[model samples]
Target chain A: MAAPMKSVGSKLSVERPAFTTTSFQKKTRSKLVSIPGTRPSVQNGQLIVSTGVTSLDYLLGGGLAVGTLLLIEEDRYDSYSRMILKYFLAEGVVCRHELFVAAVQESPDDILQELPAPILDDIAIHKPVEQHGLPCGPQDSLDSMKIAWRYQNLPKVQSALASSSRFGHYYDVSKTMEPEIRQAANCHRFYFPEHPTQSSPTQSPMLESYSALLKSLQEVIHKGGFDGAAPMTKSRNILRIGLHSLGSALWGDDLCCRDNPRHSHALTTFLYGLRALLRSSLSVAVVTLPSHLIQNRALMGSITRLCDNAISLESFKGSERETNPLYKDYHGLLHVRQVPHLNCLVSELPDRKDLAFKLKRKQFSIERLHLPPDLSETVSRVSRGELAGAAMPGSACGSSTSGNKHLDF
Target chain B: MFTELNSILNITPDNFKQGEFVLISDRHTDGSFLIHHFLSFYLRARCKVCFLGLVQSFSHYCAVSQRLGVSLVQAKEKGQLIFLEGLKESLSVLIPKEPNTGSQALDFLRDPSAGLRSLYEFVRASVSHTGGVEGVEGVEGGVEEWGPPVLLVDDLSVLLSLGVSVGAALDFSHYCRATVCSQLQGSMVMLVRCEAEEEEDDGDEEGPERLLKGLTHQCSLTLQVQGLPTGYCRDIHGQVEVCWRNRHGNGQQMQKKLFQYKVHDKSASFFARGTSSAVL
Candidate 1:
């Protein structure tokens, strides 16, 4: 009644406040019938895995809406979130698609086993690991794709994004191309309504055009968008964009997590901008700051709102997965709790929900939710510079982009 | 993955309350049997009810529910046992919401014989077809009640001895919006008997001699209900005093009681190592 949990067409609705233009999209166009339960719009976008079951789409109001940002928030990493993400792997890999996982505090294997199909052919994973070295930024996304696409004078886009240890899997590319990674740049997708407008103080058209074009072009090439447009490009039909722990990435490689606000804010802005860039009907996913999300509940509400019409996944094997709330809200987005029969500690692709968990104190209490915006003005009245309810978990504080970027990355 | 974490995934009344049945089983053999009897009675009473035992129980329940057109969620593996297959799934549209709503289970039970047949048919059909509960065909197919009156069972002999009380348990069932039953046409009360291997005297149950046979042997079961207080309790060397077996073999009220003190003992301490549970 108060509007369903997801605001699917809200972006389009907001973008075109005056009229509903039908010709704008190649296929998708809507008047937005807001019913108690709205069925998700379905299209054969990139034909990924079918989740093996049809019921989850019903709860999702429809299957995982393509090109949507999934914000998995749990008090701790748990099975539900992990399973949900693995379901995507099954989707991406089995369907000849690819998944880019962004977990700053977990190891890839720790979560991969929870999925049903362990050998994820379509999954290009990125999980943080202290013991084992792994990419920690958008730079990684860039370097790997280049390596995957431009290997030994041939298009090896897939290998560039894939781990070198997996070179054996791609004997053709591994034999000729350089195994070393070229560079890594952290980013997901960007909403480019206006082409890198010079009007916005924060935006630089050159950087915007290069970054936006490069990221999308990688997928477009993966979509075979570059076969005729550019020579020496062979990647097509699969893409996974991961902004793994963008918040932490924003903090300098040296400073502790608590010390960098401006950096964090910029990272948040970059992510939101990417959401805007996703436009409509392009399938993509991003996983980031799960624990941070749970810790900053109030801020996450706005973040979740930003990721409207999205699916949230939990890393079941993460240290704190058991206590997270995402396990409950997403309705076991992964099926981790059912792994015993399969006789695997790690479930395989198609896990979309973790086990059930009850919180001693719900991160977002009723009172903290549905608060008015004037709280920010109240905070301003008393403080130097804090947004309304900035301290509150719902204030969307965790990823606030501090307009400070005079320094170097 | 099976972490040693003891977390929960599903609670009885979840966000989407289509239908849920939680089984709280006590390890004691007698207690478990008694609880199972009551549970079976409820499962029989409500077409929407399901009995989930162990692993096999989950599969059986899911299959049965599928047959009955009732949506059931069961996790197929051990690591994520708490995760159910269909709990978070949304198939309500597939299941009819208004399958001929009569508004009253009693008002429709006016025609006694047809009412009972319709109730059974409704259940059997649901178990057999996708839209069985809709009662489009077969028994339990009619909703026009033939004066189905509500009866409350109040005999202590049945409630205390077996550690089961159809009369007590039915209180929850009383909340049913509609029911299928012809024998219970005008009366809301029904007789429930414990299942056992009985030596039939080659006589129909319709004879008075059957009732006179009394109890042949005391049941070997003690019901241990958690979170329930024990009344009429006695202190035995090994048995829980709150509820115990009636020692008389031929007595109508016969039962089995477990004899053991929960000594500072690690007897079945194997399970104490704890199991994985989802907390989110």
Candidate 2:
């Protein structure tokens, strides 16, 4: 049905089905309805799957839509983002969905082996309930008399982990998922070093690894019966594609090297093609890009625009924020850059922009960032204002308002 | 089609002249709606259209246009539309098939250095065909007898992403303008993605910035879509800025107009600045 299909050979034309009936079926009668781990979004009726982190799913307005790509802009050290990717795979394994793991520097097997074990629903519900309980007793009653008393009846903001319905699972970061559990689902690996590269004399700027990855992904989608074009003989399953640390020098993209990278569009082009592939199939991909190293901010912006949903992790690794007592409870900041606006005019925006994630002993959780209240009676208003200024640099009015209150006193 | 949008942009069939180049650009927002508007606009004007849709699939455009009271399938069957699906073609070319020596429009997929001459030729062949002379629809209104051939590209930025240099992409569009616009008394419209300058940027022009500046200088009219400076809102989706440039002798006079727009499923509503219900 494609225009160029006429001029090209029959082999190329095999991809485009004669009847473009697959898309119309996508809206209401999608075969994806039968797939495990997917649910129709109440907002727009688009099929969605969790991103492993329930709070992240809530931030994205239900979950990542089927046939959509979720881009995770890596933190400075790439530690937290890696953990998030593992959560994604772990959730897939638990849901019996097939997994396609592609990586350049690290082996896909190693990454899969490190997936956090999913905690039992009862145990997952126990800890957060206690945490919520401890804050609601005499301490809250005593604190309610403070100047922020107006917010007392505003319905305690739901904790990120307090999911009303059991749609997603919480994982224990300390334990590796059992081998038997991990092996239950099908897993495809694309280790770049092992894949043979086609060294053409023409020397296209697009790296051989990218084309290899795309070919491998396309093959898996078609062969695994994920493409909706063909009727299913066997039961359908979702393919969870996890691509780790793309656009780095290891992938042969020069975007991270110089101000004006020669192959600036290489990563973006690959993403565009990759998105096209995902759109026509029963697949959901979570790609983690090392955006911190990318030299051109504008290129990063374009990359963000191309994806359906994008969130960037800014970890306080070596920065001053790490040592700042104000941010001691949080390990990093999670910036929700773009949320998918599928089948609708407006996307679901995160209720609060100031979000922080903490890496606890056995779990990783994202929570609303609230500055620890300055409760010392001996401390002066001037020092409190300075502390507020130091803690939240983005909000200058926090300190100025405190200063104004001091003047009135 | 979008009658309100058409009137806002003053897009009358006769208003567009031969050799006229219209550049549609967007920053910090999705501007594909403008491309859709122009697509059905030309089709409704009885103009033969050749669409090089790189961002989306044929079904997507077809489904959207269907809501706007136009059947892209019928148009394609009647030879009134020429659609080049870039997404499908790019993926197929990425597959390592037998290396043929033929210079197809997608030769750049096999060879990045290869220019877009073959793609340009494809457009020319499709638009230049004189279907009126044939007995098929010769008596009725054929493509040649209907209106001038118009070339529309959903986006040109993807060319840069596909490894084709900015200069080659410009040359490709330049040639299309010559053959389709100047020679055939038709018009050309291209959509380009331009990145907004960040605070830290020192205004050094290169890459997308340079390409946008180059295209802006050559095009007779520019339509820019930008997000609300204050941020997102419920009623107003984004703003559209239309600039008309008329060159006379040694100098050029420019007229600029701005409108706030909100897109719906079937149609889009465009209003003057400060007129949106949210703002009011």
Candidate 3:
């Protein structure tokens, strides 16, 4: 037997034995199915892993719906972003499906560095940089016009398609990358209307005009050329998305926040607008905010809702050496110390014997921060502390469990 | 026996064999990597392993599989749990695909978003083998323990890891099925904003430096070696202790090992310090 365990959608069909359920009514099946060299276990289900970034992937029990989003954030720096982008653009990401990444703030290069280490090569980063409003020529201009028309006209087609019954979270965010969006934003059709075989290269003035610009760039390989082969892909996971420094970008929209609805409202409007925009487009979205910039509680609540995974950035108190020199200060950088009740920080050295005695401070042992390994454990820990860092432990509603159970669906 | 899985999941195996495996994980971040590495390791030895939750990127999976030692399997469809038990009943042979021998660097070009599709193919082909004997079982989501066909591998080189997500230590607890208590448990999972313009070299950390920890784990031990054939594998054997200050002004130390280095060069195998060996 051969099985392609691709997405959450597929697992819905595996035969699970019917058993008395005390609470959750998740799908169950019972049967003996065999794949190439192994047997499926009816006992234990797959394990779930949280990227530890925060507020991201919690909905799918810590990832995209095995068939959907990965919720990878973006990078402010170009190289890092490229690294992030490459993780979704290159090869081996998936041998069976088309890969795509959409970035509004970061360019392709900006997304590359988002990976833990930058050797990732199989994903496709859908960038807006390439969609600089179609190509440039008569046919190209016409194509751009059509794309614009399509963008506006998409609502109607999508209204029907959306109504055709594919209900999920990614409906909105993915629309930007939908076939309809591409049909309206065709890069090839706008610029290359006349068959390159029918007309002389010189005859197309529009194409010729951009020739100088094209000269510097590596010409795309024409068909029939010995093309690069795609590497074998082995991806059996979620589509990760990262919204790196979105608040900073919106704040950077202008010189100062003076005239723009105050800093709080600006943040409020920014988050609400994007949140509405992405509800259907992406499976998951994580927007990180620098703690220093958190000026309002109301706006913070709305902004935090944008991501299912929420990690507060911990401020770096010591020299830059205390930090990974690669990236700048981020709230996500906080080293979360796991406890049994709620999440707590190994912060402050227990507020006792240090600072005055520098020598003793250097010897601070990491062993004192005894915590449960999992975040859920922290909920138990938090039940004891009840501080800002503590998490609510084991409540029917707040039972220290933060993961969304609906993802199993 | 796999019959134990009958109450937990929707799928189960028809028969129990010496070479089959069933893996399960709690909602920790590195759970996926653990399952992948375990599967790849077992599969290479002609054993089969099924993964439930989502895992890491293709490159990470490939790197982990190659490094951890498992038969390479990537399924991309949903409801695989539904069809899983059926696929395990008839398959009697382990088929080796082409050596995916891809480098970690190549992963940058790979599309992690497309991982689901491949996973789908892996699931579909396994259960629906037209004329195969079918007796596999599936574990419905969230019945944590007591769920199908189970493989009890004697050796687990690396325990379950949290994939850069918070609460990785807790995940490790579930992976090891044991608790890890630490005093100063600090971890580094997120990416840093390294300014490319800085002329600092990648390996030029003169003073103290933080390394990536095995996410979602508590370590009884963590250590690091300064040099290997490559430059001394950092976090070798995942034996580095992380120390941090707590609210009471007391220094704490957590016994968590973030990463372990596999001595690539066998000639250098004789070079051992504090029990450094191959990852497998």
Highest lDDT, which number?
2
* Number of the predicted model whose TM-score against the real structure is largest: 2
Question: Who is ahead in lDDT, 1 or 2?
Answer: 2
RMSD of each: 25.9, 7.1, 28.2
Per-residue accuracy of model 3 over A321-407 as CA lDDT, tens digit each:
234322221212322211110010010111211101000110100111112223354454333333321322236334322334333
TM-score for each prediction?
Answer: 0.26, 0.83, 0.24
> Looking at candidate 3, what TM-score does chain B attain?
0.25
DockQ (CA atoms), all models? 0.01, 0.41, 0.01
TM-score of 1: 0.26
Q: Give the best candidate by DockQ.
A: 2
Model 2: colliding residue pairs: none
Better of 2 and 3 by DockQ: 2
Lowest lDDT 10-residue stretch of candidate 2 chain A: A1-10
Q: How well is each residue in A196-240 modelled by candidate 2, as lDDT tens digits?
A: 886755465566778789889999998988887767667878899
User: For candidate 2, lDDT tens digit of each residue in B100-181?
Assistant: 6333667776667778878888888888876474113533554345578889998787777777778988888888888887
Q: On residues B1-280, what C-alpha lDDT tens digit does candidate 3 reach at each position? A: 1111222222233322221112222111112222332343333332222332221223223333433432233322222122122111101101111334432211211222122233234433432332113323334643121112222221121111101112332232233222111211111111111111223453532101111223112322212222222322333411211222122334454332222222221101222245554342
Distance (Å) between predicted and true CA of A247, model 1?
3.1
